[model samples]
Target: MYEKELEAILPRCFEMYDFMAEHVEQLQHLEAMPELKLRMAFQSGILSFEHGLSSLKLIADGFTSSGFALMRPQYESLLCGFWLMYADTEAWFNKLSTAGKVSPDEIKKLETPLIGVMLKDLEKSNAPAHILRQLNDFRGINNSAFNSFTHSGLAALVSNGVGYEPKVIYDSLRNCNAVAAINMQMLSILTGYEEAMEPVRKMHHHFVDCLPIIHG
Candidate 1:
């Protein structure tokens, strides 16, 4: 059954993996002025990739855990939480990606519900209804693992000249990475592919590697 699902998802996963991989590599090339500046510039790309990976992990976990009888008890709720986390993280990344692309005023202007677009795409692709609900639930939860970080939060504020620090963004990006790694390990197990997590991991590393160009 799991293999069957993998067979269905493999094509989409591979495609998304490649798409993300390219961006990650491109992100690595973006470099800033000083060492700290360079690190800061790369941080958002890292966070976006990690958060995306976490989303993929949740989907994988939920699908995998749904198959068993006894394991279902523990894994079901875990899977649910991960699913919500995935949606929330992706929303965060999409928000940052959009915000990062524009001026401070533009960031403010772009603050509508864009994640709804992504959710629609997911629904059109036949993503589970429950997963969609999970995402919606996550949207309500303000207690994010990544967003609460001082550096990341401050950078968000500072970017808009809101008198916030930049260091918060740096810390938040790391927090995103930590969650991604942990989440993907479980996904790898569920998908029965140690390489399941490879694409995203490599994507993050690739982005980090290209920090030089992205900063410019």
Candidate 2:
């Protein structure tokens, strides 16, 4: 049922793969951030790029649910990465110390602020105003669908157990790339270096074809 769609979309998918690969290559030599906590958060957010790219590949192969499944889990980490940076860095570590060291199970028990609250704190932290504002507005609009995708909710469960439409997958890939572009910009912010940041500032302008239509 999906062969023709795959034929049409596969080339675009490969182009995105190459773009992300180039990004991975581009980010390879970044020096660690001065503080360990900030460095960890930065790395966690960086992870979203590869994760998003992988899900794009899965979607291109006609695995819609699997691709949808990955969207939120990693993206949440990206959000949390920001939270750790601005919202609750010391409190989190203090909690971690109660466990004598980092324990995965204990970490899970720790409370994370909701997305809205985190964004508020990020804004207060003086994160880039434009990015912070867009993140807030975008979450307001799409959080439900994103949450559904992560938790196997109705949106991830399509009718008749069939693959998603090719256009849907194509559009999904574009949106994912848009998020990746944001991720790139965030990474550049982390670097605090113009050389690492210059190209990222023009990512969308250069690669608009494979990215979603974004204004701002």
Candidate 3:
């Protein structure tokens, strides 16, 4: 794997994690909302952000394939959060609330839309246009890679088998950072404190080098 090569990038990756961690900590206390939908939306975004940070740790330690496997969940959580905000009428949230006390099998029976359905639903729900555009672009570019990583396809086999370059690790880290930024921004929105997001914007621009947008 990239055991030796990882050293060259670990410091920057760690810094990115710390920067995001700070934002997460700040957002957590600020997202106090009694509204059920907003609370759930904030929680989902936090989950996505956690996945990004966890993936960074795994990738930094040379577990690139495992790290990548986390990306799809990260993406899905963020998507679901938005879908909750716009597409849902508290139905799914209610189902989830009750499912918490139900058996695992019963919980599995909960009606949740697949990714395609969610996307279509979101479009009609007036989901943020900027987010929709970014999501479409991100998925169009990375759908296959996301599947490969999560499903242990050829891409995962290759990364785990022969290993990859340090730059690949850097790119992966940056990609995770991109999702983290999006999640943090979404959390900021939930906070209803425009000033809370000022730091988020600053953090994003300050570390924009790690975002995929920089590459494009």
Candidate 4:
């Protein structure tokens, strides 16, 4: 059953994987100032995209809950990376604080100068409208669903049965592809890799074409 579903989407998955691998390699060749926040965010996005591919492969192998659990963080890495691209240094430190990478004592010193500012507050002031819209879309469409799996909620348990459903596998692949497309687009913009544009657009169209719609 899993094999059948995997065989059906294998071609599309391979295409997306190849495209992402090529761009990831290309990204390594581009030079950006070491001090630039966008560069770090772009790198993080790339890493997340790679991990997301691994999760998708697990889904193909019938580890559906595990794959779904990985999706939220993958989405976060992309969202945070893109958000940080336009944020200031203070926002950068704030992010680290939010992630608990910074100690409370250290965050205290950092926050002294940035007393009331929060990452959410910076969104409107720093990020572009389109970026904000993308973040909102992810929150609405994927975030909640992904969270249910990540947190071991009822949705995750309900889908952990023995059989593999083709629609389930296809939807998982589509979600992964969508994230890859967004990650590539963000990297291209930040790294000035205009060559990625055509491939990313093609990938996006593939996702749109393959999406399943429910008629009520």
Candidate 5:
């Protein structure tokens, strides 16, 4: 029912969440300051989001690259990644909506309902409904954060560009950073108990341990 490697990895996720939060707070403070600080905060905020997104993708790729081996590898990484992507995209959509640049139809076109997407995938894969429900709950939390950031109404602050005051930018960045942090936390939970992950983790490690040589 559990895996050891996942246990080893769970703490790392928590650490990442805390680390991301510190940056989010810093960005928040910087947003209220002068242009110089604002630019820096925005850059940091953007970089953080990018990093968070990359991390999610990497974790997902780890699941997909192992030839879909159920024992040696689990697709939980991909599952979690989908959840995060769903959250991030929803946030962007909300932000655009708050800015009055997008209509409800436009928002609908975006992947706002990530939980449903994952559930659909699970159903297709014939995975356990109970587990899928748990994943859905996690996705819901991330999606909520996305909504919060977008709903906070940071569009005007962004439209003003780099000239905006640090304080305003910082506040906006706080929302951005919070979403990123939440994504990291979700990843941690998914990967928290390596024993839960079982042979899948070992299989993944084995693949990494063995790399095929390429000749030009």
Candidate 6:
């Protein structure tokens, strides 16, 4: 039963996975030193997207909870990476400058800014209100919901012992697609990968048409 269901979803999952890998490859070619922190964040997000793809494969193979659990960190990496890019460019660079000699500790410290702090910084920036609202929705709703799956919450428990359902698999695919699309978009913008924009835009449009509502 689950095998048949898995067979049905594999095509679409593979397609999305291919697109994500291509985007990550493009990101790899980017010169990361100028905006090192932002670029590293984008790279981390891309890596997480790859992990999500692996998890999607697991879900397709019927390891539902295991796959769903991976989504939380995957989504966090995307959002946190974008927040680092969006919040304060000057301040990020300033922090790096003040650190004097570049060390692993300094790099790790730069990446340690809390999402809450990033959001607050973003809110105070000159960015438009709609973008802020969208990010808030992502953090409050989508991220919170994804976290539930990892925490052994009702979402994780409810599907246990239930036989295979196509809806569950489809939902997982949609989520993986959405996260990958978002990560690609952020990486393109942050890395100045102009060539990545067309595919990113296409993926964004497809996601808007088919997936659950996730602002930003």
For candidate 2, write residues 27-53 as lDDT tens digits. Answer: 656744777777767786768876887
lDDT (tens digit, per residue) of candidate 6 on 96-161:
676767777667765546667767877877644764665566566556546666798875677665
Clashing pairs in 3: none
TM-score of each: 0.25, 0.81, 0.85, 0.74, 0.25, 0.72
lDDT computed for candidate 4: 0.66
* Candidate lDDT (C-alpha), each: 0.39, 0.68, 0.78, 0.66, 0.38, 0.67
On residues 1-216, what C-alpha lDDT tens digit does candidate 3 reach at each position? 554544655676677778878877987887646688789889999889888888877876768899989988998899878887889556667777787688877877576677778888888888888887777666676789899999999988987899777777766676667777788788888888888788778887777666776432
Model 4 CA deviation exceeding 4 Å by range: 1-7, 31-33, 88-91, 94-123, 126-128, 162-165, 205-216
TM-score, prediction 3: 0.85
lDDT of 1 by residue, 117-177 (tens): 5455445554456535544444343234224232345433444354322233223223333
Q: How much is 176 displaced in model 6, in angstroms?
A: 3.4
Q: Name the lDDT of candidate 3.
A: 0.78
Candidate topping TM-score: 3
- Candidate 6: minimum summed lDDT over ten consecutive residues — where? 207-216
In candidate 3, what residue range of length 10 has the lowest lDDT sum?
Answer: 1-10
Report residue 17 deviation for candidate 3 (angstroms): 2.2
Instruction: Give the number of the best model, judged by lDDT.
Output: 3
Residues 1-216 of candidate 5: C-alpha lDDT, one tens digit per residue: 123443344344445445555544444443423433223324433444455444434433442111111201122343535433322334544564565566777665543344355467555554445545545554454443333333442432343343333333223222322344333333333333333323333322433212112122
Report RMSD (Å) for each prediction in the order shown: 18.8, 3.3, 3.2, 5.4, 19.7, 4.5
Per-residue lDDT for 56 in model 6? Answer: 79
